[model samples]
Target chain A: MHYFDCCDFTIASEIAWPVSFPASREPEVEIRYRNLPTDLGEGGERGFRFHAKPNELLICVDGVARYLIRGGKEIWIEPFPHADEDSIVAFLQSSVLGVLLLQRRFLVLNGGVFNVDGEGIALVGCSRAGKSTLAAAFQRIGASLFSDELCAIKQDSSGRMMAWPVLPALSLWENTLIQQGGDVTKLRPIRPSIRKYLVPTHAKSLSPVPLTQVVELKDYHGDLLWKTVDVKEAITLVLGNTYRHRFLIGMALKDAHFLQSTALIQQSRFYIAQRHLTVTSEDAFFHFVRTNLAL
Target chain B: MKSIVWLASYPKSGNTWLRIFLENLFFATDEPCDINNLRSSFMSCSLDLFDHECGWDVSLLSHDEIDRLRPEIYTYIDSQWENVKYFKTHCAYSFTGSGEAFFPDEATKAAIYLIRNPLDVCISYAHHRGYSDYDRIIAEMADAASCLCSDTDQPFWQARQKILSWSLNVESWLSVEGFPVLFLRYEDMKNNPYEAFSRVAAHLGVNKSELEIRQAIKNSSFEELQKQESLNSFKEKPSRSKKFFRSGQNGMGYAMLSRSQVASIIANHGQIMAQFGYL
Candidate 1:
């Protein structure tokens, strides 16, 4: 049985799933799939089977399977043909990487993710809620950049939770990019929609560091308000903000993972903030972070 | 029976302006354009008022829940306000599904479809609410446009198709025999307020002298509308770093877009615009 270990969970399967061979007669990737315990109770009773076919991927659950061919961007499903294709892709991406790949663990806590020495913080919010703008602000203050979209949280053997770096990318509007001293050449046209730009961060010196806090970014109302919440509340809030997933991994495992994750968050501080509703530049955001995080 | 005129238009097309004009002409008091207060006062039997009057019974439900119960609620209110009820709706025509005619079966009610240039509409929408940037605005517009163009059978583009379908609805209602249908242009209202208001008032069976029409026009000016606290205020909680009502302007698109872009917008919604004599 080939086993892959990520933190406390170990995936072991003996099924000889078909492996695609290259011209050199070497298998490029190994595909192993099995029905394992999710442990989320009724919602987690269902199991997911994943297959990394040659240049393609297949995920099956609840008697329905989705096939993703490499060339075509659309996902095809059998028995459930009417499901939204974009939603399916988004589901696969977040689930495969966020939960299944990382071994079902809780990483974010209390509205912000803390850096190694708790010197840095990453604030995440729903799309169009000024996350990239806040990240740009932090970068302007000379803080190391991790990611603006996706971040990986892993628990070390020592029981300390760490934030793994994903892509160092930031999405901003044209006005924000210009304000942040970002170059236009770095912008890519995300078409069929308007006014969005993707700016890559140049901070390569910073690697994945230990996470301390997770701040859920919200827009400012009439006044500036910030309130620290309990870890359980923080977990619930972050879970609500997580990327949409159709099929979550092992139910019991997920609950256990979240409880453990909440423990980490409770050890730190959590907050809900209402800041001044202004389009502050990246420099101003980082300065605010420096002052708030007290780094 | 005192007739109630429904001054309906797409968002940012000047529904509030029409309301203010009517309110000033009738009430003779500048007590502010408090829509909530106005709803409870004259149009108490309308939909907006029902939500408040019923309060806990209605507000407890989610938006979707309330939307599901809207038809039943409308029926109940329709029984009460059957005689005198003037309401405004951003929804496209024929939105009232089977057996649910709140305002005289959509055929009897006076529906004044106020058409505006799509470019101006988009520009007004962009600034009226805070969007991340131009790309987001353009993307939203394109989505709306595509939805409007697609077939009715298609499930996608529910919101956009509703907007697009309004022109067809107006055309259908205009061709039909019975019910009063007045087609007004937002641009025309801007250019000739006295003529437009007089035509509307006459249709609603209201005796408006030239002076009254002129007064309504002056009172309902954009500046006056902006100054009114209720008209420019929001009841919902503000999102992170964003407000509800930002600006009110006509010809805003001219400042934001190039001539070519303007031409494209005209091309996209030209058929609807041409029907209303906007081009």
Candidate 2:
């Protein structure tokens, strides 16, 4: 079994996952690659399948993969022939692990995380809101790159919750890389037939840190519009900004997500960051972020 | 499961106007439906919807790759939802690289194609995209492979819509196999609003009295839409256009287009033009 340390879990899997975290501890979960249940336990929905009881949830991605997360301890994976290593890795990172984390009742959010002066800052928004772009800007200006997309907030023994950094790679679109004045020729595309690149972090950490801010992104419009959201709206926004929020709904984990949301709202500050996009800009939006946010 | 009803159209057709009327018929709120928060999602071009449905992020795939998997995504979403849905699309009926239909027949029950006069569509298309080149717009309409929003600069809010030529777009959906389709001209809707809309209301299986339908028509009138846009804002309006709900007229295309420009559209789409009474 190939072992890897992922978000504090020592996971042993038949398929070699690309997590760079050192595999030091004993394996807590075993990821098996085999045929999953075809019936999917019946009585649920289709499209994106998620069937759940109290301690277990089954998720299937038709003809691609099926994951059985049991008791939040082990995730049994059924991989199909058509799915490649990249696809399998994507499924694991994109939804599978996030589902497992949510099933384990962790406060997981869909945001890009960065460490600025030992404080974790997250850029959260819909896809193309430029979360990864903004997050990369923070690191380029010399902040420690903590995570790019998935972030897990776990409560330490002292009953205080902190944001746990994820993988050390940022998935970014070509235009974003170009606008930032980085050479695209050096970067590697995240997947086959995709122009988006996977830019690795130079300095990173897996240790947990206290969250400083959560800025939700809106599409590029006129100029930078900043809005400070109150706790109530922040709760809703955080819930909305969570990793595969709809999939969480499918997993029957709404109650857990709600509780986690309330806790997150109380724990961290939330802001809305708005900007605009074009073939080329006057470097106005990029300037506004660095100057205003003190990046 | 009840298959989705597709509100299909080429860009600049009266699809949004019809959707507004339908929205009023179904929801009937005291105020107009917020343009930004429309309850219905699009059929063909929503990038985020595809990303969410496929689980694998589509932003990570080539437009071609995403196009290949389009049928699966649509079928999956269609089968998942128990309630009937109305989806909006502009894609002409075409097969993918895999030789499978991009949109699945099993996922849809009916389609309503809103075809506007190509001459008028040119004016609106120019206004919508802020393109001032009239000849270019005409050429695009006649070009079979013409499409919109295919740039890879930064992921577009919508997917690429290969609408084909104006004539072919109208023909493709009208003769598309496996599902039923109804074609309504932009002029017909403008000339006989009540009759045209009533036919639409009846076709959608909307169980409403004549009075209710009339009220819906009044509520979603062109003037009402323009008024609502002025009062609040239309989120779908392009940054280029001064306002989205501008001059919903039948012969405005003729008033705006030069004699040669009109001749160009008519000559190019002559057969399809005669079929639709545009000649």
Candidate 3:
């Protein structure tokens, strides 16, 4: 058995988590390996038919595994057909964990959250927005590492949005890795089926850091246009990048996400980082972002 | 029980132009539709839409697994929306490895399959992809598994589109065993746009008058699209292309290609070329 201090939850699991945990903390969610139910019943709605729900949330990855998160305390998993092990671990570390946090009504954002000189800077965007590339480039410039893919945001005692980091690595593309002089043979692929590597970083900010700014990256072909969004739009924008906001709707935590976004925007500045849509060099884009974000 | 219109086409085949026209036909007053902000319909292979509907990051799953789960998204959309939803797809009529249809047959009510001459497609596609090889473009057009926006080495913003050959793609939609489809030819649109667009309007169930169609046609002219692109670069334009609205003429094939190049394209797609008056 392995344990992880994930966000605020003490997660005890059958699989090892990338994040660390002290055994002193009491467990909140216990993930165990078992043959999960084939169906969670017929009356509930489908989140694209890979799921069904009544009292518990059942998620199926056909020919791979099934996951049943029961009452927000236990995760039952069933591995079927394929047992690559690498992919299953990735699932636990990423989207599956994201869904659990969201089901728990905690805000999980799909972006890069890292500590930039003690102030947390998050680069949020859809895929191809270069969020990870931005984060990796920022880290290369001696910025403190945090989380690259998923991060949890919630309220703290002082009424500020605190970003609790995730895995201490970033998934970087092969082209970007080549530009950075990274050896593809050395790094581990996030999955065997993909070329994206799990490039480990230096020390990551393990505790809750105050999220100072949220920059949404967009691939604009013209030029770099950075502008601060209004508060109303900021709320919608942040929620839009909130690690599968559709899951929030599916789990009926839309209100929770709205409240979380409101709290997050209140504490952090939101900027749309519109950049050119070309195969940019590391130094060129790095200089542009560093100058604009002023990191 | 659902109204889903498909703006289906092979790449560089005036799909964007048709979309802009539709946008103007729906919501233009004194200005042309914003080229920078013209997502009238979400694409069939949109990463955001799939991620949103599945409530998970599809990048984590293999492409095959993602394909298996795609039909479910349409089912959800059909259940949720009570009105018309147009989705653009380049994927030909295909099935998943698990034998499920890639596009949900139950959800889609109609499709608009756009056909352009292969020779024009070669020039436009070469510019769009920045690859100068006419032979490769031809081979890709004839292949059964030609697709785009599927680079796995980088952060994939676009979804993987599994479009087959030019002729196969056309056949896939037009011969779906009684599925309703409206076929629009690029030559027809270029020569007699009024007739072409009016047919489109009729198929989409839009009751635009002759004047409205004329105004929309004028509004979304090739020059206007190029002008808009020059002012504020289009988000959809590939970085390699100098402009999105390149000379969208029927004879562009002749101007851009040599006689041999034209011969190569016709030889590869002779049947479909003749069928669509390209020969």
The recovered share of true contacts, given per candidate in order, is: 0.00, 0.37, 0.62
Q: What is the interface RMSD of each candidate, in Å?
A: 15.8, 4.0, 2.4
Which 10-residue span in candidate 2 chain A carries the lowest summed lDDT?
A: A276-285
Q: What is the interface RMSD of candidate 2, in Å?
A: 4.0
TM-score of each: 0.44, 0.89, 0.91
Runs of candidate 1 exceeding 4 Å displacement: A1-96, A99-120, A171-175, A186-208, A230-236, A243-254, A276-290, B1-9, B12-279
CAPRI quality of model 3: medium
TM-score of 1: 0.44
Worst 10 residues of 3 chain B by lDDT: B52-61
lDDT of 3 at A145: 64
Between the candidate structures 1 and 2, which one is better when assessed by TM-score?
2
Q: Can you give the lDDT of residue B138 in candidate 1?
A: 50
Tens-digit lDDT track for model 2 on A1-295? 8876766677788877554566769988777776667545654333445665555666666445777777777788777767667666666766677777777677777777777887887877887766677778777778777677777777767755677766767777788888788788997665555677767774435777887688887664244577788988897788778887665666677887777677677778888767644421325555665565666
lDDT of 2: 0.74
Per-residue lDDT for B1-279 in model 1, tens only? 324455666666776667767776765543444432344223212322433223111222222333444444444445545564566655444333343433455324466667676677777656555554554445455444222322211111112223333344344445533456687878878888888888878877778677777876786676655454343343221233133334454577778877877776666556766766657
Error (Å) of candidate 1 at residue B221 is: 21
